[model samples]
Target: MNPAERLLEVGRYEEAERSVRESLAAYPSDAALLALLASILRARHDYPAALAAASAAVAANPRRSAGHVERAESLILLIRSREAVDAATTAVTLDPSWPGGHLVLARALVAARSLPAARDAARQGLSLAPRSVAVLLTVADVERAAGHREAALEAVQAALALDPGNAYGRWLLAMLDAERLRVRKSMRALREVARDRPAAPDIIAMTWPIRGVLSGLRRGLAVGAVAVCFLLAVGHWWWPQVDTFARYVSAVLAAVMIGFAARVLVPAGRLPWRCLRLLPRLMRSASVASLVLVIVAVGALIAFASSGWWVLAVVALGAVPVLWALGLVEMVGAGLDDPGMRPALLGLAGELREWWRTTKRELREAWTADGRRGE
Candidate 1:
């Protein structure tokens, strides 16, 4: 039993599963092994397997509170709400002192939408084990579902204070902040959680919009730069009449670039050398570039409107490149600010690479088919 418990505690689910299987092989009627296996399966979200294992455990030992609890958890996952409630209730009645029984009952009640009952069970479990973060989280969930946002936030905050490294608690807090439209605060909180769990889908989704915004800004700048340069260079040669307007646009663009570049590059003398040295010069450069591009775009628009020589074409030529530059800047800025985005960006790159490979493969297959048909 100690070995099995130790295996479970260490998250060696395979070893725990094997140990339970071996124990069941030696003692085919062992209800405890079945119950343990059910718990392990539940953790893996193999709810059907857990249900079968829990059912066997209960059949072997109807009096076992753990077996009933395990079955109730599986039933809850399976969406058998009424049956889960009954099983959870039975488990609590069988062993009122067992925290697991109350926890299971709380979960089942929550599933059944019986918020008050769920809260009671969670409170009972918390009383039995005051240090159980799981119980506290369950209570928080009940409070949140019951429209007690402040209470829910407090409960989650308490859990986090008890264990600052609690990823789930931090994530919940971030979600609460996001719901309240605290975009920057929510992002800051999620950024921390994303550091530990880079592959989390929710984190990726939340950061995506910010990433898009930054990318759009960068792309807008680059395109604007190239457009202004081309327009001024070519317009100066062909349409010397508008030379003054072109020079004004170019001057404005240069000033904007220089100002932003200086702002980004020139550190505030107030900061220590160590902090100043750590500033990302490349990001600053990109920010400067974006500002310059925006200024050039505005100047180009003003010139085009005043000169009135195919205004749409002139505006479009400047605007398209600026938009593209803005997008790139946004993508780079997001990656820089949220270091956690590195892995997600890498993953996205990998996905794109795979898609390219697949596309090539299909194209080759189609070409081969066309050649055969021609023959």
Candidate 2:
């Protein structure tokens, strides 16, 4: 293996990039060096520049499968899924025996949403190189996208068994565990990944468990509110004359809910009031919206208890579903907000743009067809 490639594998991306560029200066048109540069650029999340490098590599040696494979990878990250599929197909055609070619083809098929084809390509790659960690990871990714979490977990575990220190494998396992609602298991694996790759952008996921706890609390609050309402109704029915006691109970319940919410929002010390101090840091509109809804719901609960207004109870109850939905939204937002996920998010945006472009083209074609038919 090249020293630069080893550096790239070990996550020394800047050093790898610098080494590749220096080597390229001596052999500017060398396909291998150009492909290596493309790989480094892709690792650094510079998809456009990576695409250019890969395209140069292909132009230098159109017959080389490695160049095509790198080109496909760059295209995939750029959200040009159809182009990526073509590039990967070319790579596979040029080197049918290469597991890397098959694996990347599987990834391209996945980007194109051809799950069955992706699975077939992934299986073909795995059969050719069962011990290859990259092949196994691609297979796992394909299975996960197909909603076969168990199969994905099995593949990931196998990959981890072969390469115990694979950070990507550990991260994938953690994500699969989290998807299965195995929170503790996910957290354990995530912490290991964090410890091993401290400077990795994936470390942002450390905040995920906190978000999960907050989301769970929101759901619990929703359910608990219903239970409290039921109990209040029962108490009122059992003793119609003692309305004061029910009002006092409602007020106490409201206060307790608010206190618990504050505690959950504040991660520091035992003081719930610390949440107020941190309020200014909640810059996201979504975060502010969630806080506002919680305040409104609590206020409505208090109003219902004090004035005996049934409308206030309805308003508070209605806020439950909204809060639950917001919790889910916030969870998704947290996952997408990470730097490591930026490339994937950019690809998603590209996919949407491509979809819109296709739609417009189809509309134009249909209009042209109608005009010819009328003539």
Q: In TM-score terms, which candidate is top?
A: 2
Best by lDDT: 2
TM-score of 2: 0.67
lDDT of 1 by residue, 100-149 (tens): 78888988898899989888898899899877788777778777877788
Give the TM-score comparing model 1 with the true structure, all chains together: 0.53
- Superposed by TM-score, candidate 1 places the C-alpha of residue 354 at a distance from the truth, in angstroms, of 44
Worst window of 10 by summed lDDT in candidate 1: 267-276
Residue-level lDDT of model 2, residues 111-193, one tens digit each, is 89999999999999999999989899999999999999989999999999999998899999988877665656676677677
lDDT scores for all predictions? 0.69, 0.77
Clashes of each: 22, 0
